[model samples]
Target: MNSPWYIGDPSPSKDESLVYAHGTIMVISWMLLASTGILFARYGRHLRISGRRKLLGDTIWFQLHRFILCMVTVATLLGFFLILIKEKGQWVSVAKDGGHIFAHSVLGAIIVCCALLQAWLALFRCNTDSSFRQIFNWLHRSMGYLAFFLSIPTIFLIVTESKVLPMQQDGLIAILSLWSAWIVIVVILFEIVEYRDRLNSKMGIYRVAQNELMDQTTSLRRKMDHNDGANIRSLNEVKLFLFLLHIIVAISLTIPLVVIIWRQN
Candidate 1:
């Protein structure tokens, strides 16, 4: 009798089950949850809802980002221990297996460390008005970006290189590849939007100078005020659209990968 989840064995052995559980947890915690958290922190600043609510003296975006990241830290720790226990606490020797395992292990360790460090930094960050606040922000952003960059390859190694549970390698690879491309495209779109905003601001300043020289300051001021309001609204709409699109796409891509992992033999 074939079980819906376990194709070859209705009852997988303990180690195999551990591997499956670890993989699924990681996919959800990092790929889905962490990605959403990071995206919200980056692109959700201008969102109307962000400032409308507060928790723990922080806005919605900050609260959501912090909560999700804290959950990722816990989930990551759990996944790490599960694998370590499966190996009986024996560290993978890079010398013996100087391949994907080595890369994955090193990268995974760094990512985990970054996660812990980020949580610690967030907890003890200086107040917004403090002079040291900028330093804290820089350190936090740097570590986060580093962890995010490393996790991509580490996750690829998990699906393609793990030995305990057999996976559909080609399918997973294709999915990850497309997902990576999607992330890159979304980031580029954001950059383009930011650039456009800066360019418009410069042009507006130039127009102000020209209007003043032509003794048209009053009319120009009225027109500029109206345009500024419209632009703010348009910018907000664009950002909100992107944020929602990202969430939808992230879930869409994550679901297939998770389902594949769950149903793997």
Candidate 2:
């Protein structure tokens, strides 16, 4: 008789193990991406309006975030393959019963789309010239909505599939899923609120600075206007600080995810 735990002779059902590991990694990657989004939407937006220079830490964090995103993309692809190859046998049962597999497939598709949008935004749209800033911003905003929509299915998959896992069936996965969902919601809401406030404040600042520059343009023609220079310098400084803060936030959010994955394994 074939052992349930051992799916086939000399093979101890690596599917489950792969699924678990890939799931955990995906969770971490998602959290990091969400954290980066929060920072960019909130603090980074403010910095852009204020015209701040980039700081060292900010540069490092941006690069690190990009690197992690790439890794996550690869991992997600691997997960797709693992599910397709290893779980082929169970697909029929999963599909016929309309259980976690359905939710997983839906969520997986959403995730893939969001990930692609993110990549496009980060690599192509974001680097466009100022003339296309509005277009880029619109794309970025749409991607954010897509990410939010994707999160719902992902949460469903996590909660529903956790019950089927042998070692992870003790409510740990459900609890974690709930906790992560809460965190994502809180962060998104907080950033939205902050974004509105920053927009208002930055517009006010820009108007005042522009007026001051206009007043000085006549007297300081063809030369560096002191007040305008000061405003530009101040904006650059704000950008630098915002960049550093974003990195700090990303690192802080990643720590808990790493810990959870370690504990789970």
Candidate 3:
């Protein structure tokens, strides 16, 4: 038998075009597009863009979030098919590396299916005030989170185990680590923003409730509303800043990864 390192069963002649296409598409879809869409969905509502522009009566943020995620779904499907075509519709086996390819295939399949299902669920979601809206929201969030987290592992596997790429694993790992750290930091920042918003809303509610119990003048109520509106506008400006920063950071990290993939032999 040949030396262990010389075994070539798994490293067949690969089509570079298909390989590059698959890698680039998947990287853009998950790292850039999906991240942007999720950010808009989570924090865009806090932003009051100029003139409060609306599309079909939905806020600009909601429209952007929906549109980007829909593109994510389409891109994911295209990437899935490209990889399958590259592999001749057969499961990639990496038993020599502790079944990494098999695991990646399984996890990737789950992520793709969840992504598609997410779009479908969005289409069928009940109206905001419907009694069953909560159920749809729960399921949609659960599936989206599941698919996103699962993709992390699958992405690592592609670099660490897949023999197709000639890129350095350590370099890829370092990049991914930094990218993930940025994501965590961004999430924490948004959490703080959201908490502050909740606190402000609670305080406003308390003031309203207390006023309702006492004799309050119309002018006094109008003044309170004006103050509240000013506060919200300021907070929204902050959220808009964060959102733009997030997009910049995401694009900065994603570009290097895509370049690395494209540069691979």
Candidate 4:
């Protein structure tokens, strides 16, 4: 008896199953990566909370982060292998064109390389001196930019190839791709703005009324030991807003991963 859910012969069904599995893996890989990125970026600033504290104060959190990194790396490798296997017999000369195939290959390589670099930095670059740290920072910044640049092509390939090759269109795939792309763009823009602000501050040109007020308060504090409650409250508010933003974005990206699995079952 033929399975009602079977859409074709065994070979085609097997191929379809492989593609579906790869798609699912890709979704998982991206979600894990996004989560790791958010967590690292948010708490990374506090890695050195106290001057006397050594290497990231929270050992448990660091371990969890490392575990997530390992999981993401394994999932990514599996996803890449699946794609290669699925494309093996279907390979054509036209794949070398400057369209979906070319872009996918280039961007996919960049993503893998960036992921490796990130892992290397996290695992090995922790105890470096200032000079080494500066070099690592530059490498990290460059890799991040490259990853964001590659995400554009990655997204293009996913949408274009999926639309053309798949007989059954999955709205969820489209939504997930768009959502992932949107999150990447938002993160890139945020980093750009942050770097620009840092540059302006270093150049002594970025000054606002609030900054001037803070400076005055600092000077006054030197002479009179008094707590500037208003400034402290304002700073706390800014911190709260940033925290909420991080949580919201993290949860939003996580939703699609859950939806995809739910639909699959």
Candidate closest to the true structure, highest lDDT: 3
For model 4, residues 115-169, the per-residue Cα lDDT tens digits are: 7777777677745556688888777667655664565457447445533333323
User: What lDDT would each prediction earn against the true structure?
Assistant: 0.76, 0.54, 0.78, 0.53
Per-residue lDDT for 79-182 in model 2, tens only? 66665555554442343534565666667767777677777677775454678889887876676566645755664454455333323344545555655665
* TM-score, every prediction: 0.83, 0.57, 0.87, 0.57
Candidate 1 vs candidate 2, TM-score winner? 1
lDDT of 1 by residue, 28-62 (tens): 88777888888878876655554354566767778
- In model 1, the clashing pairs are none
Candidate order, lDDT descending: 3, 1, 2, 4
Q: What ranking of all candidate models by TM-score puts the best one first?
A: 3, 1, 4, 2
lDDT over C-alpha atoms for residue 128 of model 4? 53
Q: What is the C-alpha local distance difference test score of candidate 3?
A: 0.78
Error of 4 at 123 (Å): 3.5
RMSD of each: 4.5, 7.0, 3.7, 7.3
Any runs in candidate 1 off by more than 4 Å, and if so which?
A: 1-15, 50-57, 94-98, 162-165, 201-220
State which candidate, 2 or 3, has the greater lDDT. 3
**Candidate 4: where are CA atoms >4 Å away?**
1-12, 35-56, 59-70, 87-98, 126-130, 162-265
Off by over 4 Å in 2: 1-15, 46-52, 55-68, 88-97, 121-123, 126-133, 166-170, 177-265
